[model samples]
Target: MNINRLVWIIMHVAANIKNYKFSVIYLLLMLIVSCRRSTEIGAPVVNSSNAVLPAPTKQLSIVPVKIDTLVNHPVLERGVIGEWDSTDVLNPSVIKFKDKYFNYYSGFDGKLWRTGVAVSNDGISWQKFVGNPVLAPSISDWDTGYIAGNGTAIYFAQRIYYFYQGINDRGIANIGLAVSDDGFHFKKHPNPILATGPAGAWDSDSVGDPFVIEKGEALYLYYLGQDSVGVQRLGIAKSVDGLHWTRLSNNPVLDIGAGGSFDENGLGEPSIAYQPPYFYMFYTGRASDEIRNIGYAISTDGIHWKKISTTGLISNKLRSEWFSKVICDTTLIAVGGGKWAVWFGGGNLPVPAENLNGQIGMLILDLGQQRDMTSFDANSDWSRSLVKSTDVLLGSFEIEGDLGKRSTWLGPKAHLTLATTDHAGNSMAGKPIIVEGWAPAQFISSKTGQYEPLTISISINGKIAAKRTFVSDDMFRIEILWPEIAQLLDHTGFVEMDMSADRAIVPAQFGVSKDSRNLSFKVTRIYFH
Candidate 1:
């Protein structure tokens, strides 16, 4: 086969793997993929013979939510007597040790920042180590000052490694590694595993918040590198033993390039979770707070990344919430039984004086919420649609959950997505496509701030047709614009639509009704036309 055919075949095989089960077969296939060594045309040999394929792509969590959400946002440890966990809770790293959970954190102790430990039965509630401050500043000949900052945490077989930022008295930030046999107690390394970046590199100034992940025998470290300009970017290095590292001469594994992009300002605090065929990373930056913001990017190999999207993750949420100011450190844990917990450290308040004494509070992850996101993606695979610049789309999801469980998508804004595909499922960029929905319902669509009898031309495939320039006051009609949508139309595809054009009344109170209880809300009824 020609090289191009081989490449296309590989891509085709990759896209379909998302449909199978995960097992040793999958791991062997993944190993073969990892061994490819190069993404180039002549990439190394891949064993296609009887290799167990990767699990099928069930769904993508384009949107995430808080589930099993903790009412008391910033969990306080009983061992400590302070509020807001003392104000910092800067870098929160959590791991599941058998059945219990452990949280390793880095906060200030009045004078300087250091690391500590806390225990938890359920992730929501935590207890600080009576003998707190599991990992502190460095005083060895190698580490001169303190554990400047932290990155996401990970658990490996018998050892727990918390990658942290070590800043010397000279204020030079470098990456350091600490390990623990048990989650509560830790031992710091006498030598910094990875130091500052080369003089003319994107991380010329310093490297901080190292996130160490072990992939096979090689341990890949993802961390933040700062240049003299103070612009923070992400870099990657690999090791076989989690010590003695060799920098990817072509460092700056990730960076903000060109215009005022969502990730333009910078991408720092690299966190990695070995999820299937790829290693996923969540980085924070200036675009993190944009109303349409949520910082993210993906990678197959720890070195080369795939930008699923440039737009930020978890955007335009809680602008007023206590921790609304930022969305940093996206942490996820597959705590068995298919539950994923993602905790973030982003609040508006400054580090309190009390917190300066060593305590900090940040947002917690609701694994149930994450599971819902997975279900949402599984339930409603996302596809894009296009409308005139002045059009809006109204849509809602009917989710069934046990008491105290709920799911939430990131935003309601109808994204004007234009991709390079035509109605025939082939690349057709810069070509016009209709923007109509099979709105089988008579109720109005949420045509907020858009054309009423909206008629517009748009290019790109306009993936799944879920949104349209329509709305209704009466909640009677059911909408089923799925991801694998049918083509846009002009005829009476949508039922109960305003056929008369303007002289029609649409209901607003549509969708499933709810019954509110003392503790939670439940969906009692689902209405469909």
Candidate 2:
């Protein structure tokens, strides 16, 4: 039989089989047999059932490399020195002046908290100012009790302006301003720049954690406000001269998370940084679990905000030493090489004594790395939409499983569409994109007739670029890669997905309490790399 005729028959059978992997294998074998018989006079007849196929060649595996974000250097640990910072030190704010790195932190003697200064050439090793407690509490002033040792500092108008939180005799926290000429000694202003809001306001109880950034001709101060109900939120105020401030009409710009959320309890200790088109806010989120971890949010304008993750970015799970109790009072500074460093106060244990006895830890965040673009987790900021058809409903779903509660549902016949521009911005084009995730096969089988394979198709610019059909009787992991598309660079496009049963099917559970049309499969994670 002619080799061409034999190859055509094999391809026809493979197409009817509906298995992508087997079809590719058959094609390769046909090529091998044809190349070997090129010099022969007549085409060799090949047996379909007994023909020997060469062993498949292994493809080179490529491992992705990620830049290290968090690099820890405990430059301000307690008990390392017995000077003015002998007892405890927390709340670190860093500023660069001329050639040295100025580290201003809060220190506690046996009695009260006071502000102190330490200078370093490289930001690691530090030497306390000869006259420590550069700005101590005044005997007869509003900030007599305590002055925040670790607060925000900036150089403007040929002077250093330190913005700190002061607790008065009534224990009410308020914002204060101090001016430093030489970056060492600071002179406090007469009155509190920003006092607590009116009784019944969101920030009625107290205000603290001042994070200031200069934009345009005005300086914006973002702080933590505790209400009479004890719910802490974020509020903003603006000042032109660095002393007097006017609170925005939309006070409490960021409120507590939804019920049963990571920051559901309250929010506190905000740190803000401006990186051109976006301003990043890092703060401490208090969850109902009694866990306080670092959370992140981003904003195009200083007022409106969007959280980066549903859960805390830096949690006890990330660092075992910090235990899951406390990680707050963050100060972010750009370290220049497409990286940012965060200095925050963390406690070793969850107890109160340990909380008060905190130390500063540093972590770096790589801005060049790819981040998650989907939010199946209830806590993320990604918006999920549910699409309904006659037989099935699809999108992010909530299902009860052996694990208390899970949000892994990707409804049968579901369509998931995400904006690539939001995650990649202008740098998306020409970058290698990988879509990888897993789903529970048993659940999917139960819903779409019985153990039928599901087909997933990815479309770029409304054109189907890649498709895969996989059986899901067990845990199914799927990864599809698309090479760089030059046209996608800097342009906005939708990465659309269609996940449906291979054949016409009905919901697995007909009389279930939940809507059958709403039943979905568990989608572990769907992200681009």
Candidate 3:
């Protein structure tokens, strides 16, 4: 049929077909018919069904892909044996600007410690700036002794604000600030931004190790506070502009642990990571033996905090091969999908402070896939608003529309909570179940530069139940068998899934959609039989 005749027929049929489904089918048929006519006219024959369409200005197709484990070793090592930073290179503060990772770390040159800058495309490989010690001690100022130890950087208001520790010749340490447009160079603020507390106060001796988090309308700075009596603790300060600051009335937000606890000696290097309702703190806790390890804490308002554990979160037992002796100076970066890149300082020689062969290392902490689903798709049953009443509480998922088919885009870690009892209070202790879903097509890994096979894993109460390591990515009507659901669910009735590929991608980064959520594999429907 000719183009005009084909168009006339489609319009007439679409108007008469009252049912929208039939109208859609008729339009598809018309597309095929027109393509055939083009081929008959000696034009290029293209398969409309399989033809690639330009990405919408907004909204991207969710894809199924996984990333290889990032480099866990020390990405930024100490300099050559006799170089300026030969002794140790630790206490890293990193910020991403202009598509590059700028790591500001303390480099110990045996006699002096200075702050240096290193650049990296990926957080894994780093190249030290030829002009090292971007921010050194001002020989004639209060920071005449050295400028080093736990520091942090943040890009705020189109500028990089660097908070660092500087000690003077009198052995007094205080927090200083430096502004940088480019990550490589910096302009120091004349005087110290934060100094010691009043005499006899908790932080009278010195104050340093400044870690800042942009909370709400202001900037909350958490730091290490030392008293004249040689006791150390953690405190919080508030600021609107990055320059000025004020300490909270209730100083020392997190004090030393109980008499024989892990942090009895002191606390330093506080790092904050916010995941919705809770703010997580990872700090260096010191013991009586002068041993230092990473401790975990949680807070609602940035000023108040509660320690998560009695022992250190990462102590000698949980230490990595290279950082076995000491671990301090936490620099946390969230790489999406509930995962945090904890870049820290570690050393071999056991010491409470600096110069222990200190090197920078990183560990990825997957806090699980739970995200606060308040405003986003509130109508979805899987949302936080309605999930309390459901039998299976999904960590994260989305519905097609107001009332359409539901799909769960499983992130690196997925969590499901089963209701042990029904609304009528009837026990549902033991029950077999089956989950049906659909997987997505495989894709190449941008991080590892390799193609990864899909893997689906089920864990019961933190223990691995089953794992399809190399399953076909095209697996449809996927059935996950749970023979004894009761045995799987913990006392609190919690279970976890590692079904999707690790590392969810942000659609906005690829210019696909304005959606900033880190989305992963597609599970069209998850049915519990």
lDDT of each: 0.43, 0.55, 0.59
Candidates in order, TM-scores: namely: 0.52, 0.56, 0.59
Better candidate number, 1 or 2, judged by lDDT: 2
Cα shift from native, residue 484, model 1 (Å): 39
Off by over 4 Å in 2: 1-67, 80-83, 315-317, 320-324, 351-355, 369-529
Candidate 1 residue-wise lDDT at 99: 64
RMSD to the hidden true structure, all candidates: 21.0, 25.9, 27.4
Residue-wise C-alpha lDDT for candidate 3, range 350-457, written one tens digit per residue: 664556787887666655323232112223454433223111223344544345555555555554433343333345344443444544334324422445665666
Best by TM-score: 3
Cα TM-score of candidate 2: 0.56
Candidate 2 RMSD to the correct structure: 25.9
- Across 1-529, the per-residue lDDT of candidate 2 in tens digits comes to 3323322433343344300124442222111110000000122211012111111111111211122444333557764455555656777788778767787887766555667888866555578887888877778877775444446788877899998766566656667778999998788887778777776887765667788876545677787776665666787877667776777776767877988777786676678865422456887776775466777776545576767656777644466453335666777665533345566776654432122456666666544323233322323322231111111113445443444333355545454443344332333433444444454445556654477665656544334556666665444445445453334222224344445534332353554344554543455444454
What's the best-to-worst order under lDDT? Answer: 3, 2, 1
Ranking by TM-score: 3, 2, 1
